[model samples]
Target chain A: MRYAMVIDTLKCVGCSDCVVACQTENDVPVGYCRDWITETVDGSYPNVVLELKSERCNHCENAPCVRCCPTGASHIIDGGIVLVTPNECIGCGACIESCPYDARYSHPEGGYVDKCTFCNHRLEKGQLPACVSVCPTNCMYFGDLDNPNSKVSRLLKNRKYKTLAPEAGTKPQVYYLI
Target chain B: MQEEIFVSGRDIPNIDPSLEIWHWPIGLYLFLGGLAAGIILFASIVVILNKEDEYPTTVKYASIIPPIALVIGLIALIYDLKNPLYSWQLYTTIRIESPMSWGAWVLLIVTPLSFLWVFSYFSELFPTWDLKFEWLKKFEQFVKKNRKNMAYLLVPLSIILGVYTGILLSAFNARPLWNNAILGPLFLTSGLSTGAAAIILLAKTAQERHLFGKVDLALIIIELGLIIHMLMGMYAGSEVQLEAMRLLVGGEFTVLFFGFVVILGLIIPGILEALEIKGYKVPVAIPALLVLIGGLIFRFVMVEAGQITRYLY
Candidate 1:
């Protein structure tokens, strides 16, 4: 089952609760982040609009990081979750460099690349991603996109949405509902 | 109607400096690896054609470059990795689609093969090397007996090695500056030109130096054309692609790209060769050195600029 996330921008409050939750849950270092929000200003002063986009690892179908990685450290496992094998990782940073989304960060302690893992540790215990479970605005929807009955799939079916950098041809799994 | 909005990631710039992963080590590795590949390619071609007598001094001296340079490049590559201690993981499983995987295996094969090629040449240059080690003498004999066959084998390997240097960068589709298909051939040409330049500087005989000088000038012209085409490709692409063009043509890297690479690396060297061709016999080593240094800076600029490319803002 291809797990995916659908974020509704209209409902998002730009509160950054998910960011803090992700950091605390993942034990991310001080200088690094697993997920964050992008805020942009549009139009001139009179008609100005602030657009906020929450983003993280796209978990692309054709991941550049995976393709460029020299070692088998960055590999796709069951459920199409792209994970890094820390022990096997040579810390060449090829994956970190190649990722278009800047999803991966070089960990100060481990020296290996780290990124949003869909909260795999929590997932194994049948729990939602930290960011999704903790988002106060209820803007995040995470489920199996491959299943038409899944919440994410149903939301995608009913909503008008966008994805980042479609031209990059990464086929991102994250969807942004307008 | 749709309103044009300034787009940004939740917390990222188009090019995030804080997320930079590759550094000087990678740039040096690319430069050295390309240099080694270029030397091996040139030497193997000269040796395989049995033109050793014509390029007598070059045959002995130039042939030694690949082994030495490859060793150094490998060391740089090893140290560049964050987990240098876990480098064995690169070989434990081969990912056919990964350029880095191919690089690991290719370097493994090319290093020792090049060392053997250099060993074969050393015996001819310094016979005393054989007196010290019986194994060395025996290995040298084996290499001498099959020198032509070895030369032929190295031809493809060296070319692949040279091309891989560029392929490594180009494989990163995320970095529009490095995603060009022309990067492979462009880097290959650059490396070979530097290799030729090195020969011009090292060859003891006037004729050999002159010949390599001529070769380098031709390579410089080709390199210039490729650079232009590469920039044009980026400029003519999508908005992000055009932004990539700014890095090389008129952005932060403008001076480095045009001043050092175009003027000092290509044009000045061409002018130097023109004087030599006109019987002026201007210093060849100077231009040769410029080309080599230019090659190094080329890798540096590419790596640095590529990280700061416009994408996924």
Candidate 2:
């Protein structure tokens, strides 16, 4: 079954609880964020709307990062999660550049490129991702997208959704309810 | 709210003050790889065109330099990696879609082929003790045949390596500045020019060899045309791409773009070539040196400029 996350922007108060939770859980380095929010201001200051997008690895069906990795360091797991094998990575940074979402980064100490692995360890234990579990507003939803009865699948069917950078043709597993 | 927008989860911020390690090494690797590929291409052309006899010293030195440069370039690339030990995995696992993977494969195959080619070309310089062993004779004959094939095979391979360097950057569609389709051709053309200039300078001074005047003149003209096309293509592209032209022409990279790439790399070399064609004696070393410098600077400016301009708002 395909796994996916649906974020509700209306409910998201631009709180970064998700970012903090992911970092603390994964032991991600400082300054280099695995998940973060980007704020865009539309129109002039007086008439502006602050658009906040929490970005991370899209876990694309046709991931360019996977395609650009020379040593097969970047791979898609059985559950459609894009993961990096640190031991096989030569730190070429080609995958980092190829990712359209700008989701990846070169690890400071390791030097190998890294991104969110959908909290694979947690998934194996049948636990929700840190971001999903900690989100106070109940804005983030994660479940089996392929299972018709799953929360994410039902939400996708009921709500109008949009994927980031649709032009990239990456078939991102992350969907957003605008 | 302000704290959340840009706050670190860990008490200590993870700012790597130094830019990524891959930056310098990758740049050096691309430059040297292009140079080596160009040199090999130039030498093969001379051999195939039956002009090697006239420029024996040039072909000899050119062939020798590529293997050395290839070794250096490969080392620089591997040294910058986070896990240097894992570099050997590149050879074992082959991925066709990745340009980096393709480069690793190319380098592996080309390194030994290049050595064999150069060794066979200079076999006469080594003392030949004919061993009566049939197997040894057969091995020698096989090497000789392989060398001939290498000479012919490397022409396309060199072009591929040269162009692949440009394609590496162009593959990044998010970076509109580097996504131009013309990058491949422009890189291939510049590689040839730089490669030719390097050989010409080295052969004339280091090896005391002279090239056929007509051939030198012809190459210069072709190189000039390619540079013009490359510049024109960049200028005519989208505003984001035109930013590259601006950086070169009136922007921060002006000195490097006009002073080094255009004037020293193309203009001076073109003028000297013209003078030679006009029956005027011009020192070949001067123009050749300028050409080599120009090529190096072109790569430096292009790479630096591409990185500095960011569209991320």
Q: Pick the candidate with the highest DockQ.
A: 1
Off-target runs (Cα >4 Å) in candidate 1 are: B1-18
Off by over 4 Å in 2: A157-160, B1-21, B121-146, B204-251, B308-313
Question: What is the C-alpha lDDT profile of model 1 across A1-178, one tens digit per residue?
Answer: 9999999988987787888898899898775678878776667868877677678999888887888788778888777788998998889888877888878887777878888999999889999999999988899989898899999999999999988888888889899998
Estimate the TM-score of every prediction: 0.95, 0.86
Model 1: DockQ score:
0.53
Candidate 1, B218-260: lDDT as tens digits: 8999999999999889888977788889878879999998889
- Cα lDDT tens digits for candidate 2, B1-313: 2222333322224522222223666777777878788888877776777676677655676678788888998888877776777788787788988888888887888788778766675445454755468876676668766654667888889889888878887776655556777677767766776676676666644223234334445655665676677668778876556766677679998887888777778877878866765767787778777777777777777666666543333
Top candidate (TM-score):
1
- Lowest-lDDT window of 10 residues in candidate 2 chain B? B1-10
Angstrom error of the Cα, residue B243, model 1: value is: 0.6
Fnat of each prediction, in sequence: 0.59, 0.41
Best by lDDT: 1
Supply candidate 1's per-residue lDDT for B203: 85
lDDT of 1 at B151: 77
